[model samples]
Target: MKARSKSKSKSSILFILCVIAIFSLAFTGFKGFKIAGWEIKSIGEAITKGLDLQGGVSVLMEIQEDDVPSDVRQRTKQLLELRVNKIGVSETVVTEEGEKRIRVDIPGAYNSSEIVDGLSKTGNLEFKDSEGNIVLTGKDVKEATAVLDSTSSPVVSLELNEEGQTKFAEATANNIGKTISISMDDEVVSQPVVQNAITDGKAVINGMSSMEEATKLSGIISSGALPVTVKAVSVKNVGAQLGAEALPNAVKAGVIGISLVFIFMILYYRLPGLFASIALTLYITLVLIVFVEMKAALTLPGIAAFLLTIGMAVDANVLIFERIREELSIGIPIKSAIKKGFENAMSSIVDSNSTTFIAALILYFMGSGAVKGFAVTLMIGIILSLFTALIVTKILINLAVDMGLLKSLGQFRVKRGAENA
Candidate 1:
């Protein structure tokens, strides 16, 4: 029993720890579970999808402002979708209506009129001169967009007309240390310093709260370049006062499904069952984290897709563990069995998931609304499952056994007729 060199054990443990960290940071402790002070997670956070599951209200909005162009309404609709999200419930759906109208669906919410009012008004984009003079206005500016610089600080950039550019350069050079006020729909957006003379028809507006804000301003500025006046012509004044009751049921179903899956895996697999259960738990945590981090909508169909992904993840584990048991029963040592089992079964795991992932891809492009939601979750689940089953679960079990965590060959339960035994 010569002691394993510290480096040998250290590297093995590190790889296992890497697998754990990916999921732990991903899941965020299932709301913060800890293992010896480190939070337990599995992958990057799983983003939640919207209903198609939770059920939300859909409202149609019409644009009537004479100032707005028909084509620009679509652009305005996209921008409004971003802005209305600030109220922050969960998932909000905004889509274009026939030319002069738009539709919005706020999940688990029937009341969003106030939000509608705020987004209905066209954004006001302006540029002030060295001495607060109205210089290049949004009308003269062609476009504005957020771009990351080498430093990665979010910058909102503007391009102006030749006439506007000349005026801008002159304003900037003369107004050094002065502020250029920017406003949208009469609301002040930014008052950044005139850092230098801009003779290149381009300007960077500094000073903003967040990248999110910068993105919004860029949209607003462009909204002004191509003005679109949208007024709510029709309001579906409905309240999901009824949906509040359904939210709890969605949660219950998710909990029950996961619990049953865990029990089944453990009952069939023995010690390896416990290992697979742990990995499956990690799988779920990551999926939810991705949802919250990405602001994905948690719809009912999306939840079903999530559960299906979980089962697939378990199947991958079962396949690999079964392969390992087969190897060990043939008189191979524990170390060789683990490695060979994983290596040989890798092909099968890949073949099965690849086809499923491609199907999800097709569904995502062809489907609309709820179908899209289901497609997205299925795609995400397949990717995460592959990582967990092929990499994370195998790494965990191998590390446990390598670190002398398993006491004997019996721990894996390899036997004759093991297929039915």
Candidate 2:
């Protein structure tokens, strides 16, 4: 028994030390390691921040009429979001603010006026015949790009899908020797005369005076149109100062809260508490790694969800630890008690976490903007917490028992008088 215990102790210690070292390096980063696909940095630096944290432009747009339908409002918000994304920004928030107003928040944006002007346009790209008949719409265009024509003039190029190709061919064939006007929002931007059939599924708008105009027009064309005309009511630039101050304060609070939990667990559960703390650390490290890999934006609400997950992780540990103590009080062997404790607690852990997971899914699908951000982080946390509590904590505890580190009942927070049955 002594020889077996010694061997188990060596192996368990080696495994535990390996886990600690690897996670520590991942959390803080190492000189040679580049797991985050770039320069090695702390976990905090790897995550992308939202507009509230990084600062950018915020625009509020209101529809011209008072009684806009809900579907129109949603479509407008979605189109604005697409336009923002087309300009190369990520994690932009576009949501309906009221019955007639929509709000847009673009992170890392510097040109407020440019964004507001570009995003508020009623895209409505239309191809019209010489007789003013509609030939094609923006929906039929597959791609749009800005390029210089052979004459050294900037123009917007359009690649038509099968449907657009057919319609455009018919329109050009019929309008030969006549001008077909290309218009956006009822304003004609190009009126090129048709010289040939031009049935190759491609067309060009050549009225742009500069490359910038061509690019902007192409981007707007690529990102579809809004159903209704909206006007920007407010546009402002936000600074990073608010998030800079709040981030540190939030981190400090999380540290204090986790530290208190650590102290309480160590005092109440003795040996088991120390193992739980280590598992908790691993849980946090894994969560951060996942966020980095996903390139997820970390907002203030996301940070709050992260902290809440720590408590949920610790709660699972508390449940399993209590179960083990109960089994120990009945004079069960340490290894058997650990096994039974995990088995008994599995159902409850799955039930609770699964319910919360469902709720998070609902919030993710039905919610918008900041609410979606909160739901995403909460879902991630619950998953990682479940993994640490059920798998990592169990392995650590079984290792301790195998290494004879739990020979005394007091190690499990049970009374010493509970005689071995």
Candidate 3:
């Protein structure tokens, strides 16, 4: 009797702890707080909005192939993405359009002309001496970053590879007082006189008016040269007003859909359904927390994917509940039926969720823009749904049985003809 009493005590404590954790996550997700000088953002602030939901510039560029191979065009597109990202633009979309076209969408950017100019260049960085003798090129550069000089002025730091280091050292040693002009796309961006030979593979270019200019220059140099040229053929601007209009309706539909699911589950399955509903609520909260933490961009399709997974979450619970009911009708006790139901339903749940997860994984890798966002959210929701259904629901059901809230098989509403003898 004492051992049984102790076991129940432990179970009760675990049940309380689980409730506390769920509530804590919900509070943080809905209403963020600050602690120890660190601020945690609410889910609304944490999730990044995409171009369709926020105002941005979209440009369609046609590659000037000029006998360039298809592989080089693909590589140029990738490099362009890197340059865009390096400029501190988050949630930017760079994707291929057709065989020779590329599309770029930068959200929350007001100056489309500046962005277009920045992206149009081939970004071929070159260092030449006073007499116009080439010394080092972007291919020899290992990395570049923007930093402050000793006098607090903004400057760009360059780190070179072995070959660049050798060539640069020789150039600086030969031209101690002469200016080495650093140019991008045949335009001189910076011209600095070498005070001494730099043998450590590191150098700094100082002429930037501000940190922003230095950052842009560093980003361009780091992005490397494009394999082929591209010219903007079309440019479109998406307004934030459209996104603002669509957001509320999408959220309303999601809420109404989820509420309906909750009502259906409760009316049909009674006690088990109520437990499933609670677990599902926890699952949604956890999924949002994950999205915020991952800094994932939420698009319109992502919201749809989230709602779809909510239905799938309840489906798993229904399968387990029906299995439990079947076991109860066959003369099994409530506790044994609950355990057996989960054990028997595990395989089916795993098979279904795994296949869905694989599909989402494929889409994420192969798709771009909105499709990738949908795949990301779907993958997250599926994983969290499985967790809540298998782990959280099981724990809650066991706790209810242990607390004597669930006693007889009749509580599960077993059919008259199938009742245990």
Candidate 4:
């Protein structure tokens, strides 16, 4: 029994340490390591931040009078999604707020005027014939990207699917010397003379006489044309300078919050408390790792969600510790009490965590902007709390007992009444 216990202790401690190290190294993107190829890039590095934390333009748009029915609004939402995707605004949020309004929130900073310029009008992607007849729509395009020639001439490179490709190739080929106009809504963007057959369903709008023009073209190509011009009724453009100012304060606040929880766990719970603390540290480290791995946006509001998770993690420890106290007061042996306490408290923990998780799910589905960020972090935090409280904390205690490493579980006494149970 003693030999098995020792081995189990070693294994448990080793697992915790390994989890921490692996997560740390992954987050660092192997910056200090010389491993295999792709050392500088990892799945963890791909996590993006939201506009509030990173600073970007937020433009609120209002719907206007239209002949289209309510069902058309649903179709409009899908097209808007396609348009946003085209622009490579990977962190963009576009959703219908009501029957007469839509909300679009995009992350990261932009040249204020440029974004406003692009957004000022409805995005309407259309390919016209020589006589200006509509030949293809945004749905026809398979993919789009920003491409540059050896001469550094930037263009919006596009590819169409089979049927659309055939139509596009024919359109460009037949209009050889004449102009094929590309327009958004009724505004003309490019009137390029067809230079060749473009049989591959590939072509460029030549009027992008400058890099800015090409970039806008790229954005438009990547983000399909908006179905309607969304007027910016309310606009706020946060500068990068503001982000620099706020980051340090945010970091300090987070440090303080986590530190308080860490210290309180160690001071109150005794032997189990120490184990909980270690698990807590690992819990936090893994939360960040999960954030990076999942590419969850870290926004200012997202930070609040993370902090709330810290509290939840602490709460799990509190419950378990209280349960252990209850068993102790009832005259159970320390070893038996530990096991019984964990087993008894588990149902309550599960119930509490599950309810919170459901709330997160609802918030994520129904809320947009910062609320979504908060919801995601809350869900992730609740999950991590459950793991640390049940599996991690229990493992640490069992390992210590098996090692016969500690003199007593007596030192875990705080003068708090047994009623804390």
Better candidate by lDDT, 2 or 4: 2
List per-prediction Cα lDDT, in the order shown: 0.70, 0.83, 0.85, 0.71
Q: What's model 1's lDDT at 247?
A: 53
The C-alpha local distance difference test score for the whole of candidate 4 amounts to 0.71
Candidate of highest lDDT:
3
Report the poorest 10 consecutive residues by lDDT, candidate 1.
Answer: 42-51
Higher lDDT: candidate 3 or 4? 3
Q: Could you tell me the lDDT of residue 244 within candidate 2?
A: 71
Note each model's CA RMSD in angstroms: 10.7, 5.0, 4.8, 5.0
Over the stretch 308-364, how does candidate 2's per-residue lDDT look in tens digits? 888889889988988888887777877778889888888888898889889989988
> What TM-score number comes out for model 4?
0.77
Better of 1 and 3 by lDDT: 3
Number of backbone-clashing residue pairs for each candidate, in the order shown: 32, 0, 0, 11
What lDDT score is found at residue 162 in candidate 2? 97
165-194 per-residue lDDT for model 1 (tens digits)? 888888888888888887666666678777
Candidate 1 contains a number of clashing pairs equal to: 32
| Tens digit per residue, CA lDDT, model 3, 53-124 | 777888887888666677887888888888778877777778786577788888884567767777888888
Query: What TM-score against the true fold does each predicted structure earn?
Result: 0.60, 0.74, 0.76, 0.77
